[model samples]
Target: MRKNLRVAAYAICVRDGHILLARSPADDGTPEWVLPGGGMEHGEHPHDTVVREVEEETGYRIEVTALLGVDSSRRTFPGRLLRRPADHHGVRLLYEGRIIGGDLRNEVNGSTDMAAWQDLDALAGLRRIRLVDAGLRLWRERPAEGRVQR
Candidate 1:
C-alpha cells in the first residue's frame, strides 16, 4: 500500500474590511479565489511554508501571527486516472498573518492567476475560491486546540 501525505499552509490575511486572496488556476483555469498560501516543501515548517507561499502567490511579506486551525481532506482517486487506487489528500494548517512589508505585485512567474482583496461580506455572493470561508470562520471563532469542528 502506498500512502501519500501532504502538509499545506494557508493564511487568512485580513486588514480593515478586506481579505487578500489569490485566484487559483487549478479550478479548470477559471481563476477561483482562495487564501494566500500553498504546500510545505521538504524540511520546512508549516509557519515558514505559509510565509513563503503567501509572498510567492500574493507578492506581500507576511508573518504568521496566530494558528487558526487544522483540517484534513481526502478524495479517492479512480483507477481511470492512475494505474492503481490512491488517495488524493491534504492536511491543511490555517494561520492568521499580518502583512509586514512588500507591495502587491502579481508575479508574472507565479501560480496564481490573480491576487486582490475582496470585501468580507461580499464573499458569500461570489463563487468563493475554496477554503476561504472555512479559514475565516476558524479565525473568527478560535475553537479548542485541535482540529476544527467542521
Candidate 2:
C-alpha cells in the first residue's frame, strides 16, 4: 500500500459559552463544523501553523496559550483507476488559543467557507468532524501525557 502523511495544527478556542469553528467540505463533500486551523506549510512550526490557519479560516489573530495535546489517526483509501490502495496517517496538534484581534469573517478561496462561534451547549446537535470532538477532549481534559484516551 502507498503511504501518505499529513501533519496539521488546530486550535481550541472557547469563550463564554461558545467555541470558535469553521465550516469545511468533508471528504464526502458535505459541510461540517471543524476547528479553526489546518495543515502546516512546509518548514512551518506547528505553533506558527495554528496562528496562520486561525487567521486564514476565521479572520482572527490568535495567540496559542498552551500545547493541549496530539491526536493521531490512520485510514486507508481503496485503490482507484488501477492505483494502489493508500494509507493516510494524520498527526494533529491541538492548542489552546486566545483571540487577540481581527473581526469575524469567512475564509475566501480557502479550505473553509464559513467561520462562526457556536454555542457549546448545542455542539452535540451539529454535524461536525471527529477532530472537533477530539480537540474538545484535549482542551478540557488537559491530560498530563498530552494524549487523549480512545
The per-prediction CA RMSD against the true structure, in angstroms, equals 1.9, 1.0
Query: In candidate 2, what residue range of length 10 has the lowest lDDT sum?
Result: 141-150
Model 1, total clashes: 1
**Model 2 compared with the native: what TM-score?**
0.96
Write down the worst ten-residue block by lDDT for model 1. 77-86
lDDT of every predicted structure (CA atoms): 0.84, 0.95
Point out where model 2 deviates above 4 Å. Answer: none
Per-residue CA lDDT of candidate 1, range 32-147, in tens?
Answer: 78788888999999999999998988889998899988878887765555567667788899999999999887757677767898899889886665478889888888888745
The C-alpha local distance difference test score for the whole of candidate 1 amounts to: 0.84
